[model samples]
Target: MDVQGVRAAYRRYARHYDRYFGKVFHDGRKLAIEQMAILPGEHVLEVGVGTGLSLPEYPDGVRVTGIDLSPEMIQHAQTRVEDLELPDVTLLEMDASAMEFSDASFDHVVAMYVLSVAPEPERVIAEMRRVCKPGGRLYIVNHFRNANRIISSLERALAPLSQLLGFRPDFSLDEFVAHNDLDVLEAHPVNLFGYWTLLTAAREPTCRGGASPDLERSIRSH
Candidate 1:
């Protein structure tokens, strides 16, 4: 799906996202945050923060900037932030593939259920790495093409409907991690009988020395 397709599909789902997706995806979301072990006063960037279902769960002492491609979705997140009185939370409608933040702007970055719907997943992850400080954590929660052959085929069959579904059902985990060169520290299945995977990686300490930036090194041009 292209940018416009993603925006249009999400605009339609923005209004009811929480009602349909909030609770079911809670376990993975909760686990992602817990594993990050965020410290007070640290800055976190949450890409594709639809409806801000995870907003209230964050520590008030930390600062969180969440961005989404759909204005309608961000608007819901805005409302959620206000209603929940999320202290240092900010919501913006922006493309994940192309963000406006400066390099090394965040202490940690997370993309929950975001990669599948992103127009350019590579660019999005690059931006995430670019903005995250060296040695910071990266967390991703998403569903990938199932390992079982029958299920994998069924997932691939749904690829044509991605524009309407707002996310590709056949996204690959191994290829994505390898292509992005993420040094995944831990990866495990979570939520509803392991329908989704939670992955966490850490940037090497040498990144600040400009030894290896953005994990993929070559993606900085994006």
Candidate 2:
């Protein structure tokens, strides 16, 4: 799927997207965010921050930078930021597979229900790992092929259209995480048939240094 095309499609539905999908999506988001346990004074990067629904959960003084591929979604998100009085939050149009930042740039990275919709989910995950601080967590809440024989068969039938529509490829997440070598700290299955997994993991701390001076300097200067 063309990521830009998906972004454009979302724009046409931006006004009602949340209202229609909020219950299902936010239920997943709430579960993921709670597991993240975002704290005060942390610098967070929210990838694919459509409509900024996660904005309210972040505590004050926790700096946030959100990036999305959709400009229209960002417009509505900006209003939410303003109305919520979240002055420190920033949103920009960006692609998840190609972030413009140095390594270890963020204290935490979140992609809520984001990976499955990306054209290249593995590449996007690698990018998320690259920008995240060595010890900082990468959190993902995603829907995958259901386990039931009936539902799984249906997914197989619709696989082509779903892939073309930016749905995830049929892959085992356990194998993916293992291949990536991330230390999985938590994994919880949500909804019936265990279709969604809220996962958190970190890079091995053995290679991590203390906080980057440049990161600290940038935060202080802000």
Best by lDDT: 1
TM-score of 2: 0.83
Q: What lDDT is obtained when candidate 1 is compared to the true structure?
A: 0.84
Model 2: worst 10 consecutive residues (lDDT sum): 211-220
lDDT, candidate 1, 85-161, per-residue tens: 78799888888888999999999899999999898998988888889998788899999877778988999999999
RMSD of each: 6.3, 9.4
lDDT of 2 by residue, 92-111 (tens): 98999899978998888989
On the 0 to 100 scale, the lDDT of residue 211 in model 1 is 25
**Candidate topping TM-score:** 1
The superposed Cα distance between candidate 2 and the true structure at residue 153, in angstroms, equals: 1.1
Q: Where in model 2 is the C-alpha error above 4 Å?
A: 163-166, 169-171, 191-194, 205-222
Native-to-model Cα distance after best TM-score fit, residue 25 in candidate 2, in Å? 1.7
